[model samples]
Target chain A: MSERVSRTTFYKRLSRLWRNGDSRPLLMQALVVLVVLLLVVWVINNTMNNLEHRGISTGFDFLSQEAGFGIIQTLVEYDESHSYGRTFTVGVLNTLLVSSLGIAFATVLGFLVGIARLSANWLLARAASVFIETFRNIPLLLQIFFWYFAVLAALPHPRRSLAFGDMIFLNLRGLYLPQPVIEQGLMPVLASVVVAIVTALVVRATIRQHRLRTGQGTIAMPWLLLGVLVGMPALVWHFSGATLSVELPQLRGFNFRGGITIIPELGALLLALTIYTAAFIAEVVRAGIESVPKGQKEAAAALGLKPGKVMTLVVIPQAMKVIIPPLTNQYLNLAKNSSLATAIGYPDLVSVFAGTTLNQTGQAVEVIAMTMAVYLTISLSVSLLMNIYNRRVALIER
Target chain B: MSDQMIPARKPPKQSVGLLVWSKNNLFASLPSTVATVLIVYGLYLLLPPVVQWGLLDATWWGSDGTACTTEGACWAFVTARLDQFIYGFYPQDHQWRANVFFFQLVLLIGWLTIKATPGKKWVLGYALLLMPLVSWWLLYGGLGLKIVATHQWGGLMLTLLLALCGMVASLPFGILLALGRRSNMPVIRALSTAYIEMWRGVPLITVLFMASVMLPLFVPEQVVFDKLLRALIGIVMFQAAYMAEVVRGGLQAIPKGQFEAFGSLGLSYWQGMVLIILPQAMKLVIPGVVNTFIALFKDTSLVLVIGLFDLLAIVQAGLNDPAWLGFAVEGYLFAGFVFWAFCYGMSKYSQRLEQQLHQGR
Candidate 1:
């Protein structure tokens, strides 16, 4: 085939290309792309050269050094002596704590408000509208400040803290609540939970198998609960002492000394974020609920299902498909907005890594890079989780 | 039966006009009647104090903080510090030049926005060139105006400058980013994704911190960048990612027919995008664009975190003035009202634009 190839054939193709008259546009396009590419390369090269001249070493090496900063709220034990990597973990955990709490609280409030917005009761609908408008219109940072400086700061001193029963205390600092202490015998209770879960799984499988094989099935929930509550607890109690204690918070010299103290900074940040995000989430929830056809509710009712069950099983399940994507957006928003915590001295990820670290180390490039990486990782993980849920809820068909 | 049917008539009216309307709308049921009563009473309780504080008890004209000691809004503090708030530490006499610069900028912007104006392209080009030059002269005062450095820039002037500059700089960058995201080439798409996600994932405060602190360290040891310029850069970079995503949503909503028609018409992608697709997409996204603008306006308040005195910062600074001590609530309320007005107007305008566009469609 190579031997048979002729100069005329190649020339014909080349001539045909010129004759086709598409070359001019193609050349223009190519030139435009080339110029743009050259400009980008020039900029990048200049930046790199600038960095080199300045003696600024760029990379991930600084992550191994001592952080030299204290985080306020940490899940894992941490101190100023910890490595930057560990400090970063602390920051990440604090971020997760706020976002998760915000998500849970926002979802509950959002659903209530959203349903209220669509309620037949005029007062309920107006109240929901008022809540959405008032909260959503104000800037979240301002709300955080309001909560921190105005509301929380106005609370009485610890000695005269607002008493919420015998187990909890409230002051300018935050809500202080009792912490439960698990005793040695609690192992049996935990073991029972594990047994219960396993038994439930086994029962579920058996019921499905029986339904398929012989059109017969038994409710497995009671048996599973009995197995866990009776079997595991009895076995564990015989082996060890089982006891429990609750330590109630009490006002001391200037602050609560025992139990868990939710600092005002955390409270303010969480409250602002949850309330602000809940407004948007309420709109999302309202839209989701309204998107469900009336016929579905009617059909459920026709099947002899109670109104509450109809909502729990049929309406919510379908509405969730609509709810989840926007809910994910709101989740991301809450996470990002939590950075406002820095304004009030909540030592979140941004405050610790981006704010304090940059101040101390003066390694702006590396510290900023590290901060961005942390946020990016969190955002991506949240997106990934939501996407998986989205896939599961999506309709499947041949 | 026919006589009975003929005798059937409308029910007698028990009420008329507002009474009937109120009965139907405000007091439709027992609970609604209670809500109506409570709401009216609540309004009566809340509004009079607000009116008194804002208007009746306010000090309108004063030279200093001494004029605002009463249990009312410290308008005199705002008026006395108005210059400080508007131009920050910028020189006093040169403020007139800034005012002139602002008026000219507004005139030019108005010219561009008005459809009847000819030479749209040339006016746009001039605007693109003149804004930076005039603002530089107005702010830095190098070209015969009087050089006032960025440190002196604060208050409404600072806010307006940041919003305008950030919005303008972000537009082109965001458009490119959006195009890159939608590009057919995998490498280009990946690069765009990385850039957008990196910026979008983090909060603007982090970015600002980087700009103010890390950026100098990244460049060189002794090379100093202007703090205001750095903040502006941070604002632009952070906002561009969000703007790109918004633009991308609009881009995606354009139907395949539009693309195919452009293709069949032998139009290049850039040509089609610029001349046809973008206009339609942008019109469709007017509400989203306006919402983003409102968001950007609110976000300008965050500049306080980095020590720049925007409106909120100025109010915060006012709270510390010995005469106005313990007036944080009043200061914040004033600032909040101003912000609310601007944002509310933008939102309302967007809603109107949505209706306008819908009708046009």
Candidate 2:
């Protein structure tokens, strides 16, 4: 193996590797690599020179330094005394909170509107199209401003909030909801809830196996599920003796206190992100549904399935194969758009970490790189999961 | 029986009459009926108030917000600052230059978008070469014209410029990236894939932040970029990743046979891509390309984060003025409407183009 080939044979092997001398892709690739390496080095050298020129020390050490700034909508335990690392965690949590909430609401609303657009009823379909067109065309930033400054800011102050049966209140400050308080012994209840879920899943899987193997439906399946899912949790709560109370926010001095508050920054960001993204999701869903052949629906109907059953069983499963890829894209988009929360002081990753921390520390390279890395991880991970799903569902050819 | 003359008597009342149509469509079932009623009620609540606020009670001629206030939108504010929103601080005398450039662009776009227009080759050359020169001369005003600095350009003018430049500049680079991603060379392929993914993974805001703040550090100390140019660079780089994907879709749809055919015709890879493969692939991807352009156009609003006063930022600037402090709603609505109109119009054209191309294929 260590022996070298003869010169004539070596040249012959090289000619074969070069694809009969058509062109030199290897040469081209080498050139590209050299250019890229040179570019990266030049950039680094210039950056070092500039950093020295500006007297700005750069490192990730700034992340451990005192943040000394406050974020209005932190999800984690945080204060002015926390480190920039904690601020980063808080910003990530807030971004995830808004993104997950937006995803949930947009999925529900988008599906409904998508179905409405397909409805036989002319009015509903027209209304759905109008909803899509109006929201889809407007810039999200403008919509964010409209919701934050125009609508929410115009609400009355805490002293004269629009009370909702006195259990909820809307004011310029934010939406105040009744907070559910559970004091002591909640661990048992939570454990029972998890147990109930596990038991339900086990029962379902067993029933499905029995039916598949023995070819018989379990008549008491619904009752068994209900008993496990509902009865178990209720019994655990009774035995645990946990006390629960609902506390409505009350006006304290000039501001409201003691309830779960959804600040207007979050409200506006969530609303804009949800509404804007839902429009795209609606289009994706509509296209997905339309992609299902009409013959499938007709064939299912001919087999005596009702329209609803036909849709649920036959159309939806097929439509999902079309929907998941674009739906994943929209999810990625919403996550990225959550950064727009910076516009309204929503304390997202970009706003708190990149905007505020970078300003204070003047570690532009580190701060911005960290921010981009977080988003990149999110987008790449989601797309990777979607790729696996796509591969699983892709049509297999002979 | 064969003639079936009885069928011609009249279609059943269940299918033919207006009442039947309404019953079938508007009151088809319980949920639909409820939806119809709720929707009508919603329209009743929303439409009249919207019309009344927008038109009936709006103050259209006032010079300031304090003039002739009513319980409706102050269109007067928009009208008073309309020129500012359109021209920004571009010198009042030099405003005609901006107008001429806009008209030239409008003509170019119409020529490109209209179906089967003649002189396509000439239009391509003009768009590729001449228009950029004319625009720079007309807007930047250095050739026998008074120089208008970039900061003086803002509002809708800057918005269009950013979108157009981003679209034009990224397109060829996007094509190259797409080709490189599909290249047989492993190193080039890996590098292109990494470059595309790196941009696509991050949000545009981060890209803009890096461009505006950290970009100067990556260049020599003597070099400086105007804020608008930095923002444009960010937009182009961010947009190219998406554009590459679209073009890749087009390229992928071209079968391997075409590549083999080009090769058999004694064409090198670059020659084949440029002379044969690209034209056909580009035709397939027009609508997809247009869709990305709409995205880039809407994304132009993001420049405001970097302190560039594009259309939305101009409105924001106006709203910040002491005289117009309370008209955030009016300012945002106007800016929203303008953005919506452009986006909606482009999207509709793209959709129609897709249908037309699909039918042709």
Candidate 3:
């Protein structure tokens, strides 16, 4: 009897613990933790053993060593003498430069083409659809190759460069444009414009309060605001002796000099990235626009708003609410895809730090970790910002 | 309304005429008319020269670049290297093995895709299990067949192999990760989320770099994987994260009632998942899975970074050949067309599947 009672109690306790929500979940979680810990430990052990056997020292100190590499194009001051750390900075800035440019161009083109897809004109809509289908279906890497090796490489040599109105030049090497060199005096003029903007904002806030106190005063004094915005900047510029001059690219040696030089690699990468990403963005934009019910547009028009205003004030705002979440994804993809620059030797972060540095130092672990970390930080921050915007948009609907 | 539903009479001939249709569609307004004219003018200026260069003035039936005597495209390079582009460096004598492998794939894929075909279970089993073994035995070769190293594989064959293998290997992993992500256990969910986000945050280039560079270091010295296998592993790891998110979307849509019903039937978690939950979730996510497959197909081109000569890489290499030098335009056009055709076909099929699934729902 005693044995039976003890067995029953033990079984009862075990079954109760298993059936309970809290204990079972906790036990499952603990088991998962244990398994993961074991796997991580095993991996670490193997890694340590392998590293030791291969005789590859791992540390971030390699960053301070000289890179001894010549990046063809850099957004920052970079040379063979620069440290690996400086190469990293240059790589990051170049990546950002291309990504931002690609984003701006893709957005503008995508919106135009996306809106065109819905045009009443049959030919225009078909053209837009054809573009989206063609670019979207092909891989971006192949497009990059087509642009670089096929199209750009086929351009005439620098001696017979195609010149546009004596300010822009295109050749096998790159596209060159006259850069604006601002004089030292331009600083005060820029400062004065900033002051004028602040003054205008202050004036508007005071006017809003004034209107609240007295019904006679209107809140928007367009004339006064316009004068503050434009006249102040103009007057300051006239007095500040600010001079801006164009620095035209001149044929020097084998290449252009003294102007903004877009290396062929960057150009091809930008063109391919913009065209490829724009196709997807266009689809997203079209879907967002289509998601806006026709009844809403009809209602807006019924209120006597013009078609343009209906789009700007009513339809676009609603469409944006749907467009942005997907737009964030596209932006993230573009940023990540920018790493493909390595294939074309565009000196991106991966090419410079992860490729050159890792090869020179043979520090695969440190270099790859840092590269992955930079991307992780970028992706996380971008997604975080977009999420906040998404929340605000969602909140506005209520 | 007539009781017999008076046969919908054909509208007046004037209304149905092409002139009226064109008026509404192409010239509905001044801007529309202008747009029509502008597009027509643009096409007029562009189409003829493109057509001439690509077709009329192009050289064909040539063995080398020198045979091209025209001022237009020299398609001779593509013609001469067509076998290389299709089969890579696979030995010419045994090229029929590759053909046989492709035929098997066609039959198996046809069985799944034709809709009227039966034995979905058997087909899936053969594809997921037996197909890989057969492909390896045939392509890599052993067991009474001469051994062919993976390095010899290149061209469109490699591209398709990488994509198919990546999709097949990553699918089960993606499902597991999705399940882990939606698990009630915090550790599992957190780990799944971290794994997915880590992979998603980086580019495939970096992942390939890791696979080619660091993966060997993580394993024992004697356990070295082949270069192609390493690249495939990287691809699977990268693609599985995307697949997980797609599957998770399907899992999230599954109602709580299904869970409760499965539990009430005295089913365990795995049993419920395999029988009740996964079947519906997988059906719901078939379109998404296909989209991922399309993406993977395009991404296989990136294996060039790791020194694998996929179709794009093969074309790129062909560009540098002294005999075929300066024919970059023809080389790229052929490769681009092939990629475009495959991707477009898959995307269209995916759209049709999505619509059919939606209609069923």
Candidate 4:
């Protein structure tokens, strides 16, 4: 009985020490929590009071109202008579359009510039360096403004437009190019094209299998090209009396007619976004390519690969592992920066939905919420896609 | 022993002349030589026009476009509007107040950044708390000098003020948020996460729009903040999110051993952070912080969208002036050069800091 009582006393002392041992840190933590909660509460109270005093109803019911703005270069059909929701759809599509074009052009230019920077030719390397430094240092918005207000705006009017070909022209008004119209029996031609692609893949797989079974193989590229390229066109021509034709842009009074027109606004925005972002992308690409060791090329050369083959087969594949993450970052930045197009009155996502629709509906909360949600989704998805790509290319070790 | 056997060193070879250097570097092969010539020609075609238009044929001394109707660039628009570009519509007589405030700010920043500030910690505290108050008095001038309203402030002055104030306010808030993100308590972490994600997910333009239009509705009726101040707050809040992310990166880079060491020494978490974690983390991330500052400086141009006449906005305004019609190129080029200089200088300085950190390591 005495031993049991001693054990209980020991347990009681241990509990007492544990309670007060970490008390000070816990108290400081509690104080922090208290301050945060109190501040939040105060702000919310103030906001509600402010809203009530201003008589502004803070709800999101206005999204269904008619939006009175038109967006340029929308992927989907849209009209000013549509609801704000539809306008937002158009805006998002336009944003995606510019961003995708910017990404594609910037990637190609960036790779070329990056390679040129590492060139053996002295003048070419210096030129690339000058390009990178000059473009990257300037503000992107200023470049956009310069292109819009200075360069593109100074082009000759439609009557005196610069002609590229019988079918194409460049002018202050817009770029005019022939638009393709689907002829009868086009679906069968498209089906044949798809079939050709599938057959090429099958042939490629069979070749791979044969090479593995017996260490002898033949080049499949010529056959694959013939199947996909020549086969489809031939089939299309035979099946549908479908003939390719160009509708030349003709000047009618003040404007050009008889072709699809790309406005100067879109042209300026695309040019500025591509050129400005390409400078940054070029740097990222250069860093990524440089991060791959010279020994990689040496190894490929030592294995009897030609220089061009070594670059394509060995050097680039490794460099891509380094290139993709920062490339995704540049793409995201381009998408975000496209919002600056609103400054130039380009009917982009921000201008259509955020500027005009917000003004009409006065649903500041809902409109802003939608706008932010779209960008966030774009940024998040691009990052997510890159993460997947990164995992695919990442080095695997035991 | 060494004199018995020695390796002979030959004189440098004849394959080291300028011609050889040119061959190796520029004309390593036939294709490279062609590439060099083509690039030189391209530069030749591009550079001369720019030089002629921007320098040789440029009009430097004039106040209007009529004085520069020659076959040259009329740069007079920029010069004529230089005052508006720098000080906006701030009353001309009281421009000295803004100048004084800017001077004091520079001094304060210099004092804080230097190594030999007497009583370093307390002086820094004073600098942090006092500079803003003194500058405010100098700017607002309610106590003594003539009062200049916020709306009258524009151009580079407004841009600098907004950025400086935003940075000053955001730093402490950013630190707190960063600490909260790493806090042991679930509530604190969640709160910080929500705060950071909310601000970060939205673009700065939308935030500015909210501050200008929606914020008024959130405050009590008739309790109006200056439009510029509202924009300033938006900038601070948005920047704080980015700053928090940067600080969090720095915090994550700190080794766990440092934390454990402090804990082993019977230090509280706050004590550990103040004494051990921050100094090391900050040193590791100085370059990143400066890059953020550069980005923030560029982003200040967005205020133009909200109808504030910043440097870019003033230039845009100048472009539309009837007297300066068709001179948008000159105006934009001037603005671009200014922005380029500022950003490039900061980026170079950051690079230097990065080099110093490498040396330290």
Clashes of each: 3, 0, 0, 0
TM-score for all models, in order of appearance: 0.82, 0.95, 0.93, 0.89
Tens-place lDDT digits, model 1, residues B1-361: 4655466766658566766767777788786777678867887999999999888887777766676767777677666776776677767877886687678767885786566989977887666556766676667776565677787778777777787778767877888999889987566677687789888888888888877865664454446788888898899999989889989998998998999899899997889999889888877876886788778887888888989888778777877788756556666666667677767766777788778878986
Clashing pairs in 3: none
Q: Specify the poorest-scoring 10-residue window by lDDT in model 3 chain A.
A: A53-62
**What C-alpha root-mean-square deviation, in Å, does candidate 3 show against the real structure?**
4.0
- Give one digit per residue, the lDDT tens place, for model 1 in A1-398: 76458777887786776556566445444655688688777655655676677576667676788887777788899998998777777777888898899989998998888987886556568978988877776778877877787678888988888897878888877889899987766976787667766876777778778877887765344666567557766776666667779988876677787898899999988899989889899999999998989999999999999998899889997888899898888888888888888888887888777777766665566777777787788788888888787776664411
Any residue pairs clashing in model 2, and if so which?
none
Model 2 chain A, poorest ten-residue lDDT window? A389-398
Considering the two chains of model 4, state its CAPRI-style docking category.
Answer: medium
Candidate 3 per-residue lDDT, tens place, B9-120, comes to 8788768778988999999999999999999999999999999998999998687778888988999899899899988999999899899888998898789888999998
Q: List, residue by residue over A202-284, the lDDT tens digit for candidate 3.
A: 99999988899887687578899999999998998888768888999999899888899999999999999999999999999
Arrange candidates, best TM-score first: 2, 3, 4, 1
Give me the displacement of residue B262 in model 3, in angstroms: 1.6
| Model 2 misplaced regions, further than 4 Å | A1-23, A218-223, A395-398, B1-8
Candidate scoring better on lDDT of 1 and 2: 2
For candidate 3, the clash count comes to 0
**Error at B183, model 3, angstroms:** 1.0
What shift in Å separates residue A119 of candidate 2 from its native position after superposition?
A: 1.0
Instruction: Give, for candidate 1 chain B, the lowest lDDT window spanning 10 residues.
Output: B214-223
Q: List candidate 1 stretches off by more than 4 Å.
A: A1-69, A194-242, A293-310, A391-394, B1-5, B12-80, B96-144, B217-224
Of the candidates shown, which would achieve the greatest DockQ relative to the real structure?
2
lDDT per residue (tens digit) for residues A1-398 in model 4: 99999999998876665467566446556777899778778767777787666566667666677776666666787777878788887888888888889889999998899888888788888888878878887778788899999999999988889998677899998899987766665667777777877877887888878877886975356666676666776867696776655577788888888878888888999999999888888888889878989998898999999998898788887788788888888888888888998988777778888899888766676777788888888766776788787776664511
Return the top candidate by lDDT.
Answer: 3
- In order, the Cα lDDT scores of the candidates are 0.79, 0.90, 0.91, 0.82
> After TM-score superposition, what is the CA distance of residue B296 in candidate 1 from its true location, in Å?
1.7
